[model samples]
Target: MYRILIVDDEPMIRKGLQKLVEQSELPIESLRTAENGVVALQRIKEERPDFVFTDIRMPKMDGLELCQHVAEMDADIQVVVISGYGDFEYAQKCVSYGVKEYLLKPVSVKGFKGVLEKLIRTKSKVSSESFIAVTLLEQWASRMEQAVWMLQDAELDLVLDEIQEELKTKHFKLNRVVDMLAEINTLLEQRLNARDVYVMQRDFDLAGAENEEAVWACFTAAIHGYLEELKAKRKGKLKDPVEEAKLYIESHLAEEVSLEEVADHIGLNPSYFSQLFKQSTQETFVQYRTRRRMEKAKKLLQQPQWRITDISGEVGYADHPHFTKTFKKYEGCLPSEYRQQMGIRA
Candidate 1:
């Protein structure tokens, strides 16, 4: 189902389009009417519709001006300009402003339906590909947390490279790409908080980021500087025992390692180690172990040949349903959904 906004100065044409949409079998969720482009823009800002149908010559603001505004605000909205036969030449000029289709005045049932079907098909395909791109970026964010924690500069560079490539391949708009990078930064900051490493939000001058490369340059420079500060902080610490516990837990991610076992391995009393662990790292032993297992499971899910059951067992989950539930809680999606988004077949 989709929502549509009809913009026209003529009351008759607006009523006609509304009636046709109501009489049609297409899945239209709602319909809104606006007399001019100014009103249409107000409606769009209030709640964006999937499609906007506007007449070319309206008072105050016309369809062409409306198309330009929509393009600047959201690249996803499908704009169809309706014009009289005499205005057809004028409507053709709207293509440069990202108009999806130019419809002739007195819109016919056949022509309107064809346009509707075409737009829906295009939107569906983009939606699926966008889902996959977002999932990949999220996985990259998880890997980034590890790289920063271990102070691995090479791995950080590689992760950023992978992120930039994914964004470019998807051909995302500059604003959307910036939002994605901000999301990754938020995730990184949250994970770093557990270790008492608080980083100030970088003041990104994105006004100059008119292209994908420029955006990437801004993001990488800020992140690299943040990592340098993290390194300096690590150098000030003396012999962190928690690092040993983390190493052991990461190495035996497939096994259920108990806190007492880890404490004995690190030559500390279990009680003392438990308190020290919580003081040094804000997370408890079980919480840390679960987070690592879930992150490991996400990485394994990328491989299509690996069965979901085997991946669960590999991450120390003996029960399949439990693994699915835990994964859903951690990633906000099922293991199968995650794999599908990563381009893995069932």
Candidate 2:
């Protein structure tokens, strides 16, 4: 017998949500609604609902603020944020405030029901240790996905070790570990390009591993082999115009590199080269060059001997102010601030 609250500005949306919850098979004893966070906060204080489904934007005090307030008042109340595609990033921020789930706009009946069911199941179980284990496992899964995308072997190894340690510390069941491995396979499959047959074969091998140690060995080998394959493919394709263009960019990072210059150097039309570069590298020539320049700048920043202006010039930026601005936008901090934060003394 759990209480629930639905908060939204639109009357129709609020009513629709209420009807959906009513139709749900969850053991909700009572359900309530509020037009905005201000009103919702009052209802929450009075009713103390076990769960709240909220929309991100409203007239008075948006969903994020509401979530923050609710967190302070009641840490146990589960929050499900409803957001549109445009609000997706804002919705991700809600997770830190203990949002249990996010539902996009025009929420499907199935999605709604699934979220409600998970919440109901979790509420019925009162084990704090179980909750913490699930949280840690989910965090580890996210880190693993990031590591795979960045092609970071060391990071992937660290994350794998962390996952294994988490399982050992929590003493998770064998079935749970297998489920986590299945999830890892699924994530790797999503990140790996479809055309990578060798990596896909390795993925299959990893999935077929019979034991924990086998799974670990197979996964490590598979990922390492995949990265090696990517490197080999890049090297093998040196005759490719795109690869030549990339080489030209890398060699001319300290110069004012241009698309036309690289295209001409590789004996291709500028327009065609632009398309091929994007198709092969998944980034525009300008974007790729800028990224390379930023990477160089970061490496140079590590050396205390190099002045910020010198680093900017070395990265092909004549204007130090522009370089600083670009670096801040890319790395989320000023050059001096980043240097200080990274412990590189002047």
Candidate 3:
């Protein structure tokens, strides 16, 4: 849905156009009227309407002036001039200011529909492109978050470089790029906050930046500073990675444990963490986690009040049959069979 603002000095003309637009039914979410260009421009700034229908002659500011302002302010706004005059001079002037459509005097339904359909087509195309950019930004931001937690400076730089290249090649609008950068900043800030990292003061105004380069620089600089802080903290207080992984696994026995997550939690490379874990414990990380989970499952299974399916989930297995199979393999008996041997039933 789109919002439209109708600007005209005459009240009757405003109502007539509003009625016509409502009758046309072109996906307009809102229909607003302004008595003159000044009021219309204010509404345009505040509302950021998708379409602005304005008359050429008006008090305080005319349609020509409004067209120029809209062009300077935001080219995304579709400005349509509705005037009683058939002057070529007026049409040329509007064209100079990037007015999309000029409807002379009374607007015919057919002519109005043609202009509206064209504008909607253009807006849809832009919207689809913006969607792709947003999706890519989100995916990259998630990867960047993981890299930050894992203290992988190379991975972080690689993700940011890919994002920068994508923005340049795609030629996304500066505002859209700013919005994407803001989203990345928010994600990183939340992740940092979760780990009790102090977020640096943000002095840069992303939206007010002069150009895309400046915006990208601001984002990358902030991320670099944040990464440096993480590095400093890691160096100042190094913990045993294997011990941390063990603690993490113990807490998350009821959840699916992954080596990568454990490595990230301990700020070590996943492969290095896996090797260190094996060296330290004489067992692979997966083997240790499975043993811990089975130990926990054994205790839970011993309780006669606990159901077998519930016991399965209590130790991270969501599939009851798979849990039973694994339990039989490890204990040489199914969970129910083990319970029966212990003089229990479910």
Candidate 4:
């Protein structure tokens, strides 16, 4: 069990840190909080937490002094500094006192979680190969997150190329590459609220990739395509009725969704909504819905646990035969056949 301390002048910051720590899956024995370094130092002496997350500036006994004191008292205690951009250089000086990581002000959840995961990996003494893999995964996840947010296509391509080069150097097996992709997806989902934004589907095949280079090329292409989709979605005009309607359709793919229902959901007339939807998406509402349903059905088919009948119902088909016909129309194969083709048990 790991004991932890959160020190900051702001009450809200302390509360936020406490909540994040409590919610984390890591094994935490106790969490202590303090408004300033003076209180934090006193609490540290009394409680002796294994880790300290502290702000650089405080009313009394700032973080630097507290770090020095903690270092003098016990070298085992790990310190993670939280500082504003202006104080970054000052925080860097705390490295000599053994500050483990530096988090900028207004910390992002991804960055916070990444730092904690890194610390946990360090304490557990993970194997060098595994450690390197984990570190690269986190770095790629972070860069991908930023690229998506900023809509930086060039940066995304650069990062993907860098990852490809590194994968070649490491000579990761196909299974290991697949596992890494899955882990990256998990991280992206956590950071991007992807569940609400888009449906993640395993619709690509990589079994033909026999070498590390081939595997990474296929993987990178898939990731690049997904990122481009996200970028396009983000580029859609803010508060665009067409985008909102698409979101409604995505969220209600399992339901008997109609143009009128979506129009009403977004406060638009049915005829007008139909026109705008077609104009914006370059497809009729029915066309878009069918494509989305087929895409979702394909995703569900990848899960071997879901039967064909269940998948039909999951994608809004009441009649199994109708689902099969529609899936074949869109995919040139039945759902089960598609699954089998992907080497997934049907």
Using TM-score as the measure, the top candidate is 3
Scored against the true structure, residue 258 in model 1 reaches a CA lDDT of 96
Choose 1 or 2, whichever is better by lDDT.
1
lDDT of 2 by residue, 246-291 (tens): 8889988889988989977876545546655775799989999999
**Number of clashes recorded per candidate:** 0, 0, 0, 0
lDDT scores for all predictions? Answer: 0.79, 0.75, 0.77, 0.76
Clashing residue pairs found in predicted model 2: none
lDDT of 1 by residue, 142-219 (tens): 788788778787898899888777777877655557667877777666766766656534454443354566567667
Query: Model 3 over residues 93-145: C-alpha lDDT tens digits?
Result: 88877786878777888888788888889888987864545566668867887
Q: For model 1, state the Cα shift of residue 135 in Å.
A: 6.2
The order by descending TM-score is: 3, 1, 2, 4
TM-score of each: 0.43, 0.37, 0.48, 0.36
Q: Which stretches of candidate 2 lie over 4 Å from their true place?
A: 127-346
> Which pairs, if any, clash in model 1?
none
Model 2: which ten-residue window has the lowest total lDDT? 201-210
Query: Which whole-number lDDT from 0 to 100 does residue 34 have in model 2?
Result: 95
TM-score of 1: 0.43
